[model samples]
Target: MKIAKLAFGLICLAILASNVVTMSRWSEARGVYDDICYLRQAHLFQRLGLGGLNTNAALDYDGYFEGKMKQIAFAEWQDPIRWPCHNPMPSGKDVMQYPPGTGFLLALFPEGHQVAPLYIAASLIVCGLALSGIAMARTLPSLVGAGLFGALAVYLMINPAKASYSVAPTMAVCAVAGFLTALWLTREKRSVLLIALIGLLLGASVNFRLPNALLAAGYAIYLAVAFLRMRTLSAFAQGLGFAAAVLVGMAPTLLAQAVNAGSPLATTYGSADVVAPAFDLAVLGQYVRDMQFVLIVLAIGSTAWLLRVGQGSVRQVALVVAGNLVVNLGFFLSHPIFTPYYIVPIAMLSLWSTSFARLMQPEQVRQAASLGREPTSLGVPSR
Candidate 1:
């Protein structure tokens, strides 16, 4: 399976690489905002370490409407620097509101446009690896589902206007991919130790983008519910172990924030005026109404499917999907505007369902053939 997986992975990588190269060379929207700026931020951090935050940082409160503020401003996507006062720009340095993790990630690239292709390809690969991990985790055959996920990820990567790349969606992709990989690791029963390692990595996911907190929480909730169903003391220990691992990972960032800016959640990317106390309740109410309509349909469909397909690991997929639904609900209850990137948590649920669909495939043609003659129809109901 490893050999087959590698072969499939390489083939997929080649296709993606070619696509990225083509996009790089031929696309009219080269060196655009998100494509250039986000990559520039990653490149800056990867090469310069934390010190790079000093270069062209934007205020977080400016929000997303103020337009491209600066190099680092583009990094955090903060249009307005949310500050204690209306004018938060106290010093020459802009707010580095984004977590240090992405800066650290950005550090890995060569500074400037020289390595743009490498940077874009790397992002594409991260996305590909994420999709591949999700497909593989559900015990799905690589030959079938894995390719589609990679292709979809690549397609998504290519189609976005240049501006979209530098903003929230790119970071969201990384978080989505990371969370899916983490969940896959959990499903394999790798170990609490490994899950802890993943939890620490998840800290990066959460710090780079706030929405990742939702994704991480969704996974944690899924595990909690799964353990409850199993009713094992060890399961609780595992959950604690995972949380500890996450905290262990998150500790450094928090400590850094405290030392550098006096708060764990300081806006290095600048700041935002949007306070938890001041959220537009009216807009949030509308969001909730819209989300409710969507979830109702999904719940109805999932319930119908559950009744038709008897109990098994597949049911666990439903539980994971339920966890994701809760994350979306939380988003709706608080944030007024929903972006395309916000759908990331649900994307994991889609991948989970796809994987489960693969796992439940007949062991052999003969087993499937026999099922037709038997009362059951491959464990699905006959309409």
Candidate 2:
């Protein structure tokens, strides 16, 4: 297992280096719309932390930050705040669209390594998700579960339209991080350290994106309730401990948002609470169109698999995914505008649903662990 993980890590690193080179060259030539915005945000993150960037420069959509490198050069040569070529964009100034967590994470590297960090992080996430799927597949005696996981990861990583978007990396990172944490929480019975680690990872996941944090919180609550129902006081206590760790880790980002925007929920793009019909629906429609391929297949497959593997913890996880989808869609429909990235909460759920089947306590696994597997009727395998 260690050797397989090491091999996977090496492959991910190689892919990361290649993708970084490609993205950097692409940025050098003619950067895409979001790349310009992200690179500029990267610069801002380098200069100021979350508070200053959100409060001061977020409203300047057409400021010197909108242009590629040349625009910044012109801005410096002319007026730092005013660039002759800078056009007035309706969206206004671009703050970091994601939560401060991701920006601060990217800021750890040198400016030139900006794109590389995203590439590395994204690759590592996909690899982790793949490994988790493999673990689940081992229990099935068939490749179905693992195959689905691999397909989903590839779809997320290389899909043309999604790859072009700014939030894809976040989607990948949150999905893998959430999956690993979920496995850690469930697989080991009730280990305090593992539970704490799970909570910390969940917090980190949420810090990257707000919706992810919501999803993790829901799952944590569900786990706590489950443990309490089983009368496992220790497990329940561990769940609470994990939740507290998440709160502690997430405090800074939430505080930054409140200080800067008067609302911790206010994202760099806009608010999540209000829905404007015209723009919101139009954007949602466009996003659904671009993502129709994987999204539809994943939705169908996840539902069918969950139905086949229903009851207990698997069902609980499925319910959480369904719940997140409902809530995320509601937010998208209610918002004044939709960004495809907003659908990420749903995507993360879909990935979780796909990977969680292996965590089911199959008879063989239970026997091996000396835990009683649910008995089968008529000599058939346990349902």
Candidate 3:
């Protein structure tokens, strides 16, 4: 299955255009899920600086109500919903909680931040979508394969049932990119630099959504199994290097957590309120009724992938997919509040894994690099 670069470019553009229009319309109206709060934090970013979302810097601009100020504030949806100051003003219920990844993107504009930076946010999301699209085409050889992959990605974003999580297209795209990055990183031998890069990528995802820390499990397991299989000291060194890099990558988010939640490992939502009983019948029942289609499709597709990619060059891909599913199910089963958007990132990651299996058919074909060649040599016995 081969998609010409031109046709692939057109498809990417179409996806971006659709997302921009949908997000623009949503930005005009009140959204059900949280977005304004992160955009508000972004308004304070330049002045407050990096990792300052939880700091008291916003207090410096309190009551600065000139028309220009009001316009900018209105544009960025800057509410008093931030961590309250000592004077204790009644705040917007919404607060900026996660790392500043999305906030930093939106805060690039100085004035007229515009009912959130829908354009900037949309652009970045579309950019990731394009990156994933290209990666899909490269992994799969045919245009048909690329078209199918694009349809899957677009459907995750456009499906009506998944719309509640539309506030976070960035996370979905990031999940796809993270999957692709893992596939590329593990396609051959690991180096200190490449291992560090993997850490950086996973860390970026964690900063976006803390639970993504689970994605690391797949990598770790793959490393462990590879070391045992090869029984080499270099493999052990590679594993250690990758672990160190993951810590380095996680540092910024940890710093932000310390500032916001007073603990590097804790989230702003760490209170008992959001925790739910394990295997909660009510939440399970709700999900079964509302999310049955998504659950069934992902589970079936992933199972098929597991069967097709049996312990070959794409083992890491399967591990990553399983990790994503575990994290998603873990959260859904345990969380007091599980929304439709919460499952989107997981779905996207699963799609990436499934596509990898489809393209490489790891059960039948392990495309390994030959000496001085470009790695597409299937059944070369080099992996």
Listed per candidate, the RMSD to the true structure in angstroms reads: 8.2, 6.7, 6.5
- The lDDT values for all models are 0.48, 0.53, 0.53
Highest TM-score: give the candidate number: 3
Tens-digit per-residue lDDT, 56-125, candidate 2: 4444445545345464353353232343222222344423444556556556678656655565566556
Best by lDDT: 3
The TM-score-based order of candidates, best leading, equals: 3, 2, 1
Q: For model 3, give the 10-residue run with minimal summed lDDT.
A: 84-93
For candidate 1, the 10 contiguous residues with the lowest summed lDDT are 374-383
Ten contiguous residues minimizing lDDT sum, candidate 2: 374-383
Q: Report the backbone clash tally of model 2.
A: 10
As a TM-score, model 1 comes out at 0.61
What lDDT is reached at residue 134 by model 1?
42
Cα TM-score per model: 0.61, 0.67, 0.71
lDDT of 1 by residue, 297-319 (tens): 54446534533452333344455
Candidate 1 global lDDT:
0.48
Report model 3's TM-score to 2 decimal places: 0.71
